[model samples]
Target: MSFFKAIRIDQRAETCDARYVDMAEEELMPGDVDLAVTHSAINYKDGLAVTGKGAVVRRFPMIPGVDLAGRVTRSTHPDFSAGDLVVATGCGVGEAHYGGFAERARLSGDWLVKLPGTLTPARAMTVGTAGLTAMFCLLALERHGLAPTDGPAVVSGASGGVGSFAVALLAAAGWRVAAITGHPAEADYLTSLGAAEILAREAFAQPGKPLQSQRFAAGVDTVGGVTLANILAQTQFDGAVAATGNVGGMDLPASVAPFILRGVALLGVESVRPRIALRRAAWARIATDLDAALIDAMCEVIPFDQALERARAIVTGKIRGRVVIEMP
Candidate 1:
C-alpha cells in the first residue's frame, strides 16, 4: 500500500486535534476518480472543521478542506481521464468525506468539474468555494431582474472571501458596490476590488427599525442575523437580497414590512448542493467575469501544514483575503 501525507483531525482523549498523518490509498473513501491534489483553499467552514469550533465535522479522524484543484491520476468514469485538470467544491468533499488537505484525493466523478480554460489550478483554488458562492449570488441577483443600472448593491461582510468576490464581481458587472465590513483596515482592499463605497460594520450591526431608510437597490449579504435583517429592511422597493453565509448568527430577526410592503426578495444562496447545470454555469461565469489579477491580490498561499493555524485565524476573523494551501 502506498502511503501519503494528509492532514487529519483526530479525537484524542476527548479532545479533537488536527495534524498531518500518513495515510494509504486504500483508506480513502470509495470513489471513481483519484487525484494528485495540488491546491486547496481555506474558508470559514474549513476553519470550523479544522479547529473543532463548530458542529461541522460529522465524523472524527476526518480530513477537512472544502475546495480542491488538481490533476486526475486515475479515473473509472467515462467523462474523465488521467491527466485531466479538475476542481471540486462542496458536495461533502471536505465534510462527510476525506477532503483536499492531503497530497492525494479520491472522490466521486459527480463532484468534480473540469477546470475552465480561463482558470489555472492555482487560480481556481484561489477562488475556491467562496468565489463559487459569490458567483452563485451574482447569478441569483441577475435572475431576480437586477441590472447594472438598477442601483448600488450592498455587500455585507465585505472583507471576507465571498463578500470580497461579490464586491469585485458586482463592480465588474457595472454596478456600484458598497462594501460593509467591520475591518476598517480593509477599506483600501475593498476599494481596489471595485467597491465604490466602504461602509462600517456599525452601519448595519445594530438592531434597527423594520423597513428603515431604503438605501440600497439590492444586496449580497454574507453575514446573517442583524446584518442580514438590516439589509432586508434597507433594500429599495422591488429589490432583492441574496443571503449566503451565517457567520454572524443563524437567527434572522426581520419583519414582514420588507417582504410585503417593500416587496423585497431574500434569496438564499447555497453552493454545496447546487444542481450540476447551475454549478457549471456559475463556474463558466466565474472563469469569464472574475479578474485573475484581483484574485491573486486577494489570495495568500501557505504550506499545507499551516492549514490548522490558518483555520483558527479565519474562524476568529484575524486573516484577510483567501488562504490557499499548497499541497506537496
Candidate 2:
C-alpha cells in the first residue's frame, strides 16, 4: 500500500498534538521487515505519549503505540519471510521511532519476535508490554532462587495490567498472592485472577519501619516510591523484589536495612531493550504457563477510533485490565 492510516503525534513549541492521518510509506523509518499491523495495545506509557502527559515521546511526528502484532508482508531479514506472524514490544518504538499506532509498520528484525504457537495475535497483544514485564519480574524472582514454599508473594498495584498478570502468574506457579490495591472495590476481581488476599494500598503507601515484619517471600512492585519501600521492608530474609514502574513517584524514601541486614535483593526489571533470547524465553513461558481464559477475562477490545479515549483512561488509573485496539 502507498498510504495508510495512523495516529501521529506532532511536537510543537509548547506542547504536542496527537491526531489521525493518512501517512505515506516513505514516512516510515527504515527497517527490514514490513508488517500489515493488525493489533496494538494501550499500556500506561502509550497513554502518556498520546496525551502528552509524560516525557515518553522522544521524537516528534511519532506513532504512539508501544506494542504491535501482525503478519509480515515483506522481509529482508534471514529469520523471517513474507507472511510470518510477528510481534514487537519495547526497543524505543513509540518513543524515538514510528510505532504500532498505524495500519502498517516497518520495524527492525531484531525488535520482532515470532508469536508463540499457543498465542493468537489478539491474545498476544492482550498480554502486550504489561504482561511481558510481569513475566520478567517472575523470571527475576525465579533466578533469585525463590519458590512457592517460601511465603506468600505480594503484588503492589495488583489491579492494573502488570499487577494483574503478576498475581496470576505467581499464583499459577503455586504461590499464594496478596494483591495490594487502592481500589478496594476491585477485591473480588483481583481474587478472580488468583489473588488469595487483597490488601488496601494505604497499608503500604506510607513509610514504615526500616525492617517490618516479614510477611512476604517475594514481590512484584509496579508502583514505586513508598509502596516499594514498604514492600522491601516487609519481605522475608533473602527474599527479592522486582521493581518496574514509577507511577507512584521516583523517590525511594527507603532504608538500607532490607538490603544489608536481611540480604534482600532489589532486582530492577527493564523490558525496553532486553536481548531477543530473553524475550523469546519469556513468551515461551507465557505460552505454557498463562491461562487463556484468564487472558480473555482481562482484555477489552476496542476499535481503532477509541484508542485515544482509552489512552487517557489508562494513565488516570481508570482502566482495570488490558485494552486491545483492533485495526480497521
Candidate 3:
C-alpha cells in the first residue's frame, strides 16, 4: 500500500485531537529501519499523548503510540535487516518521535530490538512498555537484595498494566505477592495472575503515617504521590520499593523516617532510554519470566482506530490490564 492508515494528532492553537488518516510512506520521519508495523499498545503515557490528557505529545500532527512490534521490510543499520521481527518501546517513542501508531514505521536502528523468538508481534505489544517497566522494577528490587524468602511483596495499582505484570512476574519468581487495586471486585482476576492476597485501594489511597507498622518486605509501586508515601512508611527494615508511575500524583508526600529509621531504600525505575545492555537483559527475562497464559488473560485487544476512545478510558481509570492495538 502506497498509503497506510494511522492515527494522527493535529494541534489547533493549544488544543490537540487525533484521527485515523491515510499517510504516505514519504511522510514518515527519516530513520534507518522501515517496518510494516503489525501491532502497538496503549500505555498511560499513550493515553495522555493521544487524548491530550497531558502535554505528552510535544509536537503537532504526530503519531502517538509508545510501543510497537512488527517485522523489518527495509533497513540500513547493521543490527536489523529485512524480514526480521522486532519490537520498539520508549526512547521518546510516541513523544519526541513519530512513534508506532501507523501501519508503517521508520525508526532508528538503535531503538529496535529483534523480537524474542518466543513472542509474536501481538504478544510483544501486549507486554509493551508496561511489561518492560515491570521488569525494570523487579531488577531494581533484586539489585537491592530483595528475595522471595525475604517477605511478601506488595504491588500497588495491581490491576493496571504495569502492576499486573509486576504481580505476575514477582509471583513467578516465587515471591509472595499482595495486590492492591481500586477494583477490588476483580479479586479473582488478580488472584488468577498469581497474587497471593488482594488488598483494598483505600488502604493506600488516604493520608498515612510517616512511619507505620511494617508489613511488606518490598514493593513495586505504580501509583505515586500518597500511595507511594504510604508504601514507604509501611516497608520493613532494609526493604526496597521500586517506584515507576505517578497516576496518583507527582507530589511525593513522604518523610525521611522510612530512610533514616528503617533503612528502606526507594529505587527509581527509568524504563524509557534505559541502557541497551539492560534493555536486552530485561526483554530476555520477560521472554521467560512472564507467563504466556497470564498475558492472554491480562490483555484487552482494541482496533487501531479506537485509540482515542481507549486513551480516554485509560486516563479515567476505566480500563484494566494492557491495551494492545492491532495496526491496520
Best by lDDT: 2
TM-score quality measure for candidate 2: 0.96
In candidate 2, stretches whose alpha carbon ends up further than 4 angstroms from where it belongs are none
Scored by lDDT, model 3 comes in at 0.89
- Writing each residue's lDDT as its tens digit, candidate 1 over 154-182 gives 99999888998999999988999999999
Clashing pairs in 1: none
TM-score of each: 0.95, 0.96, 0.94
TM-score leaderboard ranking = 2, 1, 3
| Highest-scoring model, TM-score | 2
* 16-98: candidate 3 lDDT, tens digit per residue: 87888889999998899999999998888887887787888877779989899988999999998899999999988888788
- Alpha-carbon lDDT of model 2: 0.93
Each prediction's RMSD to truth? 1.5, 1.3, 1.8
Task: State the weakest 10-residue window (summed lDDT) of model 2.
Answer: 312-321
Residue 244 CA displacement from its true place in model 2, Å: 1.1
To one decimal, what is the Cα RMSD in angstroms of model 3 from the true structure? 1.8
